[model samples]
Target: MSNVEIRPVTPADHSVWLQLWQAYLHFYDTELPAETSALAWQRFLDPTEPTHATLAWRGNQAIGLGQWIFHRSNWTVSHNCYLQDLFVQPDVRCGGVGRQLIEHVLTQARNAGSTNVHWLTQATNHTAMRLYDQMAKRSGFVQYRHAL
Candidate 1:
């Protein structure tokens, strides 16, 4: 945890990012189509897109991934940052990697003049919620989605 560096993704980071990305999806017991994942990678690299990604590295190995987006919000004049995904390698969990990743996103959001940063986690993700509770206030709103 001491030497961990958080940096934005680059073209050469695809392999390691993909590995972490898939691991993240597996952690949620979900799988995305290859094309969907590839498209997301492309969007992360596209400057025109609001999507972005960063990786946490310990020495030469990637230990975590953070992906976020900036978008206009109805409640604020400035754009808001949505931390869409966060994942730390299982072996490195609870070693401050996840916190560091969230901090990285927060810094980036601030730099971009976003009003705030927000994210979602499953109700059962108590371990992560503990960390999140320390870092942010609970909005007390429930999320609902309608699948097409």
Candidate 2:
């Protein structure tokens, strides 16, 4: 983790970012439309958009990714940051890369005056939960969503 560098995604990062993005989706057994993914990439590169993305690199190889969005919340006057996605190469799991990526998002949210940062994970993702437990308290809120 000490040697890893976490930075905002750039146009030059498209190929590597797409590789990690696909892997992240596959990990959750989810499949999104290609156009949706393309749109997301475009949004990440748009400065005016609230969506943002970051990649963790070890040398020239990308090992992890963090994507977040900032938006208004009724719960507070300050903006809230939603950590929409987080992923690390399977081989690099538990080696602090994930933590570094999370910390990077947290720092960004703080700098932007966001009140808090939140994210979701499947209940079966116990390994990631172990690390998450150390970084944040459980909110005790269940999520219910209906697709349009």
Candidate 3:
């Protein structure tokens, strides 16, 4: 939509960012320590940090957020961009906000000379998988994690 704009998050965006961040976590039926969220917000503001964030805005209202990090990959000489989080407002789902936020990250990764941009979503999140399937190919690798 012409009215929608996506931009990097700024320090002044703390309040609005928190709202969207909370909504994102809730959508996944998860919760984090407040301090973890606080640290994430701080990371976005820290120039030296590899973590970055972008927000989708319709006029002055923040409608979505995309958080990503750049890291070295042994498979590639260039860094890989991992899109760690993405969320669109429930009221604004399917209105192209999510797509735009993802595209924003792709552009960022490209500009930063990243070899690829990748992320994982729950297999049950079929709605988002539809969009992702259209945009990128599946890696076909199952994920396994051992929580510390």
In model 3, the clashing pairs are: none
Top lDDT prediction, candidate number:
2
RMSD of 1: 0.6
Model 1, residue pairs in steric clash: none
Q: For each candidate, how many residue pairs have backbone atoms clashing (under 3 Å)?
A: 0, 0, 0
> Taking the tens digit of each residue's C-alpha lDDT, what string does model 1 give over 7-35?
99999999999999999999899999999
> What would the per-residue lDDT of candidate 2 be over residues 1-148, giving only the tens digit for each residue?
6999999999999999999999999999999999999999999999999999999999999999999999999989999999999999999999999999999999999999999999999999999999999999999999999989
Which residue runs does candidate 2 get wrong by more than 4 Å? none
State TM-scores per candidate. 0.98, 0.99, 0.98
Task: Evaluate all candidate structures by whole-model CA lDDT and list the values in order.
Answer: 0.96, 0.98, 0.94
Off by over 4 Å in 1: none
Best-to-worst ranking by TM-score: 2, 1, 3
- For candidate 3, the per-residue lDDT at 109 reads 97
lDDT score for candidate 2 against the true structure: 0.98
Give the distance in Å from residue 98's predicted Cα in candidate 2 to where it truly belongs.
Answer: 0.6
